[model samples]
Target: MADRIVVAGVPVDTRHWIGGRRVASVETFTDHSPVDGQPIGEIARGGPAEAVAAVAAARDAFPAWAATPRAERARILHAIADGVDKRVEELAIVETTDNGALLRSHRRGVMPRVAHNFRFFADWLLRLDHDDFETRGHTNHVSWDPAGPCVLITPWNAPLMLATWKVAPALAAGNTVVLKPAEWSPLTASLLADIAAEAGLPAGVLNVVQGYGAEVGDALTSHPDVRRISFTGSVPTARRIAASAAANLTPLSLELGGKSPLLVFADADLELAVELAVEQYDNAGQVCLAGTRLLVEESVASEFTRRFVEKAAALTQGDPRDEGTDIGPNIHPRQLEKIDGFVQRALGAGARAVIGGRRKGGQYYEPTLLTHVA
Candidate 1:
């Protein structure tokens, strides 16, 4: 392993944020930068015991948070949003260094959306309306109530943005949260805990536990005190979490995998279609919503393929920190191998490569285009 390099200006201790404080763990794991396979720092390796502690903290905080006025919750949420906005550059750097995401993408796209999530939910809570109905001899009423302590398990691909997607609404609804960010990309989530504290989020309102899913995730999902579980990740993992939550009759909100297809019609703008197709290669084509499958009208297929291949071939792949770098390394060497294996299998099964179709180096895969694919 490359020599461990602690990130300057950020907490190196990857302790769990429980009850408004940092808690230590029994073991530790080294977090390495996927960009160049160098050690970033060591993170606390938590297990079921840590998960139980986090859940307990959130459960203890739920009643008070749930009773807080909607307007008050909105104010705190907005403050958190502002705090995130002020630290966008710093968070983006951490995300890039830990997860192999391009700093440019995180700074300009991901971080802004993360802040927007909080802001949007903050305003949304205030706009909520109640409904009542009166009949000849009966009355009906509808209301929204807090769901108590919730477990939010975010994926590695877009750790901070997706975590906020779950965290913002949960907090806006006055529910305490136990967030278990994917172990591969926990740095930004750790920073978020600090931001929440700085924004004056009450003790135990938001707790973060860092560790592998099998240990921390299993414990959280199965904990009886956790009322709701929100997860975003692969379908297989979602299934496992679902089964575990089912044992406790817990409510679940899962956003699983997708193989999004891009359709191009003869009347559609060719340039625009080509551009959209090129986007499938973004984030090294690791995105769940990427348009990996293309369905084009036979009339425009030839032109679209030609232009798409030309554009895909021109994309720059290098260090994620570079200002001009278009694509960064994969999340790790294993993911790189997986992408390569899939392409090679397709090619062997009859698919033909029109342009780039090879690995660049240790963790970089070329922007690939394949035709006649089954």
Candidate 2:
């Protein structure tokens, strides 16, 4: 068995990547592997002051970067995508370790998509054309321009992918960015900073601040210099960020959490529905769009539940690094506890656990199914 995993050619001890350098903070925090609760590494603990510094760096870099021709920006973004492709395996392992996601999923699915995000944005930006319309004997030119010195706040679950979703577009659009990755999963983002630097991206074009939302996040959102704010997280936190953005009248894009429900009609294909439910339960149902609630037509409900439980029970739960493992540990102990509490409450309300319901040792929770839950 592997005792410990090291991020190849990357520092295990994560630090803020600001102005194209590894930055240290006055304080630091420990990052534990959710798989076994082992200390993986320590990361710099940034706060308001660090946020201010990152914003300043991005603000200073914005003018030169934005002035660079769009084609040139596209070239740099393509190079970044190449770098990501080269390091996909290493990045996959790093992300799996940091976020308790399956290595197989990261390697085969997420990493490729992340690389595509950069390349896609790069190509899209290159082909972009402005429109000119003649109206009332006058010409009106319409073009999409960079929003200067933007802030991107990504969540812990699928950290690198989501960060790239925001970062690639911002860079393609000619914006300098200050990214704040959730403290829980800073490893991959740090690696991404390194990759971007290696790809010859200009200094200060992309900066990452590693810390909690209350400190660094608040600072970034409210900073007067940060003209745009994009965030993906819980609803309450989104509200807080919205309020902060309001102070500067910053344009904002928010992707908040949702408990998506899957509906099954009598005419629906039972096999396909079961497959979809099984897919939903992947990632331990921790996804923001996870289909946690299921509503089925009465005629098909009983049969559907039976097959779903059988399929869910068959899913393997073990070390995420293992190829055969389907379900990995929850991101942390608190998440495990939260899942358990929710299950317990449903049971108290007279719900029946048709298959798995309790926590399976460590941070693992069994693939669970509850019926008669209102």
Candidate 3:
């Protein structure tokens, strides 16, 4: 098992970044690549102790960070964005290896968006649209204030990009953030911590704790010092965090997974409809916002399904590093099994598979399309 991967001449750091320093954990977990189920490195297995330390750090740093001028904060954010842009290729490769997404998509789309998240929010912060009015010759003003010590819990599917979506705004608003990236895909988050530190971000202004949601997540959300909680993941986990945060009355923002459908009208262009249907397989169908179900007008359903299946069948699944590979392995064996279970149950219920209905090998699942349902 490799301790860490060297990407673009840098040995990836896998330790927790707390108080602007790398902190080691007594207990650690082995991070495995979704591409081949191979061990990529050993990551610090943070728990309540680490979570408490991180929150304390954020709380200690909150006053100074919140008091920092908006202009200065924006400058630091822009610097962070510059760092991210410079390391896009490295981050993209690390993310693709850690989470098993398409390398090309990460390089061309997701990683760039990660940097953009910081840059856009930084500029927006300087352009505050505070409401002001004059009443009876007296001036009244409403302005936004920083909420201190925010906790951000991001999902494994698109770890860095989604984490930054929450991190950027919270930091831009002059709040200190403690980010807990999903245990399954933690490499890029660690990388981001390094980037922010190098960009001159104040110590403890941004901290990262890497561990399972059940352990570290519970600790961070439940901590009283945390003023806000932002999470992106499943509904059940969101519920747990909400319950934990209720004691402190901490403000919460939750982005949970929901079933999405693609509706195709009879008049829709056949080619475009088929293209949209095939897109459901993007990210190996792991995306929470993916259109998992298709509702097509019966008049063109047969032709649409035919083209969709043909396209799905033609997708090449292999190692994510390969430029020719379209689809990559599922993030883990358990997720692969879960997908197969869904397809098997559908087939058992009389749904007929038009394209794929079985596992190919290892962590790869067939891009299945089923019809003739009840």
Candidate 4:
């Protein structure tokens, strides 16, 4: 890993904001730096005890927060957005180091998009109003109200930004949160918790736990006090969380992965088409919105395939921290292997490798493109 980030600032001894700052039981987990497959930091993983405690804290904080006016909540959201802007570079660095994303890339590409989400949702919340009318011969006003305490389970792909997506909206709607970031990159979540604390958020209005989903996620999902869950990840894992939430009749917002379609027409700019296909593969095609399954008009398939292969061949695969590279190593060795297998299986099934078709190292795979891929 070429980027050396400060990790000693993370809280490794205890979880905060429960029982008036009482300590909780802690176990250690080695958070790997995906750029080099090394232990970047030691995060103390919280278990059932800590999970329940965080839930209880958020639940305890919900009533007061929910009672707060919408405009007041919006004011706090503005503060959070300003807080995010103040530490954009730091968050970018921590996010890149924790998840193999290029900090500069995120700052240039993703953070701006995230800031737009916050502003859009913030405006949306303020504009939401009640409809006062007489319907069915009755007088009533239907108004939007805050959903109570919530738990957000976010993946590591865009840890800080995605958490902000949930946090900004939830806070704007006057709901308190308990976030469980993937154990791979829990440090960013802790950093957000610190920011929220400094922003003068009331104790327990926002809490974060570091741990595996099986123990911590299950505990938070099933805790009688939790009002809702919003999760993002693999469809299979989401199904499991859905099942767990069902037992409690808990409201769950699901955004499982989507297989996006990229269509290249006959008259399309070959250079632009190829550029798009290659660029979409950044993050090594790990994003839920990655335009993975391309469907080109058969008339231009051959030309498009050739151009796509040539462009993909130009992508440099190495450490994200390295400034010259356009693509980086996969987030984990297993993910690297999984993508390799996908290539191989496609090859075995007669999917022609238009460009790269081999692995470089344990964690670095080639910038590959395939055609006749099913």
Candidate 5:
């Protein structure tokens, strides 16, 4: 019941979202699930060449789409929000399958965040307008024009949520968009794109290009037609997009990698703190804002780490789809391998795993808690 089960009917043609239609028949790619090493879906394995074509499509659609009135755009967004509401269950299934996240997380966290996001951005459209003023000797005013078309790069950790953040704002601002979802998770993004189409959003106004970040993402950044770039991913990749965007002087919006730490003062509630800590590690630390590092007061570090390790040890692991499973496979096998390599090197250099530090299968990594990481 949670598989979206209808993914087979979803379009897989590596077509460009242009002028409110699907322009297919060129090239494509496959989308896989990290949890089981299964081919869950397919996407367009687009490259620099395709980027040129997609950007051209968006470029052509931009002026007209942007010139549309704010209220009209707002109406389209409201329609989109409505459509998303209808597809919440389906979207949640695909989301869980793609990222190996807890279904409850998607059902509760992802879907609601998406609904709130669309409506939230929909409301902003009402608040947007040009202002007029008078200077001492002459009239003075400032007006904002749509920044032409934008190419947004989203991440796998929080695909729909991150992409929605960019898509909602850009659409409300009257800018047409060309989005490249993380190769690791495109189901939700593709589904959202489908919903936008159903909502009657002009085709090229919101295009979905599913491919590698370097291939599809780079092309859009370097393409002259794309005037803005919004990327959410690793720092190295963000740096590349930023530098490339500079060539065209295209503006950028980036949410890059961060080594986040959470501090628990001695006076903090130990019970709640332990619960949240376990929850953080349960998702396999794939989330960007996850409390990857804990900076507990030295007085409580020993006791805190002990309880955290105990919780991590008891976490259930296996197929993400199982109801009783508390943990799922890492979203990417390579990512899991990377984590292993990092932890291994740290251990070789004296870091210790108080709880777990082993790879079970292709995508499943133990819910691990390492101490004294160097």
Candidate 6:
């Protein structure tokens, strides 16, 4: 396989990682960066065939990986963490270019968490215990075992961070993984495949199939041989995956989207409340857990909203790679349009945006605050 290469100022290995090796597809899709709507790289467009192959590879590697000692697994995981630390900058840059998240946020927070995920799980694995209980002069012991091959379908918002959140625990518990990253931001996940290989992990233990969810994702979740499935995305898509996995009775863990709200009382600190409110715009309001809806006490609602709009309007919206930028472009034009639709609908109903309600340009949407949303 060729060494990692840079395209359009982004480092990428735009191929499917199957059986611990980089494999290219006959057909490829160009990934355009949301930063400036420029081509970042051409990624292998894997379909059902690639998904099946990846699952088979994971199934093949499962026995040896499951039987491997817990200490050995911990060591390998630590090595993977080290690899992530070494290439944190490159990974951050690739994610920023691919997804238009703030580069500083990725460098300082998200990338570090990726490495930390591995290390945390590695340590946790060593600390895990089997418990025994005595009842009526009899003793019963309980233990856990590897569940077999797992399929991890991660979102694009925070690709490596979320992928590793699932990957670390699954691998640490001795189950091989077949990760299907969201198509919008797959570059960092590809980088992680390389890091795992270099960390001395065995072949077929980790596989990546990159493509649209309908093709690769459906193949993975619906596969008969899959033992477990973990997905983080929308409720509608989760429903689809659940239906697919039902055929095999596969165990599934899902983390879906919600309208998280932040509440502030009349006596609360106004400035701090305003700060937290503005933080909802972090990652250009793409954060799944962000408090998108704010509920303030009517007594202080006017003051809090005033400060929030002032701060939000002053936020820097520009290229993600720029250090001065606070908010980056939306992940894709379609996502931008969806956000606009929501804002417009709110306006049509009766609400008004005190700060912003329009797209700045290209993929950048203004930091908007809507009042009279009740």
RMSD of 5: 3.2
RMSD from true fold, candidate 4: 3.2
> Over 4 Å off in model 2, which ranges?
1-5, 8-10
In model 2, what is the error at residue 139, expressed in angstroms? 1.6
User: What's each prediction's clash count?
Assistant: 0, 0, 0, 0, 3, 0
Model 1 pairs whose backbones collide: none
- Root-mean-square deviation (CA) per prediction: 2.0, 2.7, 1.6, 3.2, 3.2, 1.5
Winner of 5 and 6 under TM-score: 6
For 25-115, candidate 6 gives per-residue lDDT tens digits of 8877778899999877678999999999999999999999999999999999999999999998888898888899999998999999999
Report the C-alpha displacement of residue 250, candidate 1, in angstroms: 0.4
Best by TM-score: 6
Residues 230-254 of candidate 4 have per-residue lDDT tens digits of 9988888798888888888999998
The candidate with the higher lDDT, 5 or 6, is 6
Task: Name the top lDDT candidate.
Answer: 6
TM-score for predicted model 6 compared with the true structure = 0.97
Estimate every model's Cα lDDT from 0 to 1: 0.89, 0.89, 0.90, 0.76, 0.78, 0.92
**Model 1 residue 92 lDDT score:** 89
Query: Once superposed on the true structure, which residue ranges of model 4 sit more than 4 Å away at CA?
Result: 1-5, 8-24
Model 1 global lDDT (CA atoms, 0 to 1): 0.89
Clashing pairs in 4: none
Measured with C-alpha atoms, the lDDT of residue 4 in candidate 3 is 55
TM per model? Answer: 0.96, 0.96, 0.96, 0.91, 0.91, 0.97
Clashing pairs in 3: none
- Candidate 1 per-residue lDDT, tens place, 234-282, comes to 8889999999999999999999878878999999999998998898878
Candidates by lDDT, descending order:
6, 3, 1, 2, 5, 4
Candidate 2 Cα lDDT to native:
0.89
After superposing candidate 3, which stretches have Cα over 4 Å from the reference?
Answer: 1-9, 135-138
